[model samples]
Target: MKDVARVIVTYDCPRNCPNCCNEHIGDVPAVKFEDLLKYKELVITGGEPMEIAPRVVEMIHRLQANGYNGKLWLYTSCLKTTKWADRAVLQAVNGITYTLHHKPSQKDLSDVCKLNKYLLENLDNRAHDRSDRLLIDSRCYTEEVLRIIGLYDTGTKHWSSIKPLEWKDDECPIPDNEELIYYDLERV
Candidate 1:
């Protein structure tokens, strides 16, 4: 397997979600600044990255300061805290993989939809200095999520992997795919 420089910045999260693959807990020490220097591509993931947005932004800046010109990708659930809509936070990230959980609310959906729209709108805009950034759809297994994937895939490519969660005997459906991509902080 090709080695990718990936780090899980924190275990703490704001949401107690069910579909989460990485069941993170409380905060931990910040990622080592030096580890980021050696990696060509850095993936920053957590229970909720937005909760630690400032730290994430600072880490990115540190990497850039050290002359690391690689790509930066942030993984987030786009919860109330992970506000990708904020221009400042969006500016720091080169790309984002927004994961959507099953929460049906107009405001929540609208917020996510707005961020997606913004990413497309600003891709090539010279004014924002984000002409070279890439925005990818990284939604996982869900009917609604799949629909969004189909929509984005019509024109652009998105990343999707099968991740089967351990189910209890009383769980409604049985898993069909044996090879499920379980989340691991070390293997970003």
Candidate 2:
């Protein structure tokens, strides 16, 4: 566990968003699974991570299997694929924050509710709180959208929340002394 790092899993997104910064970045070198163990927190972001869902989870499993106990948080819109609903998406990582650019309909909110409930029932809250979250575009943020999705009673002040979006430019710069291994971004 050392410095914080963000692995730009990929820039190849299916949607062309006005606020998206994926296309603004340079060539992203593929990252190594072992190299990822150096960070205390690894933020897995991309054009859309769920686009390559299986590989994403595989890398997560690999990290945990190798005794990496640090935080593994992912950033995705969950718009392109249903892979977000996969069990390991929540189980394998400490958190998955869905940054959506569009307004969520009743159906979409309901689906999120269903998944949040499922995670609450199955995961070990005693160890980790429900870090899964939703980030609606600030333009899409409505007063009615600010409701408690769920609360975790594991003595940790954590719960799934719907909030406005924040951008850190297009992508994070690769840190010094660290190779930006792309193993989880592309097919390994």
What is the clash count for each candidate, in the order shown? 0, 6
* Number of backbone clashes in candidate 2: 6
Candidate 2: residue 2 Cα off by (Å): 6.4
Q: After superposition, how far is residue 88 of candidate 2 from its true place, in Å?
A: 1.0
**What lDDT would candidate 2 get against the real structure?**
0.62
lDDT tens string, model 2, 1-188?
23767677767776677646645555656656677887887878776777777778777778888998887877776533235535666666777776655656666555555555665566534456647676767875664544423323222133456567754556644556433434445757
Candidate with top lDDT is 2
TM-score of each: 0.58, 0.68
Candidate 1: where are CA atoms >4 Å away?
A: 24-31, 79-86, 124-188
**Model 2 spans > 4 angstroms off:** 79-85, 103-113, 119-128, 143-161, 166-181
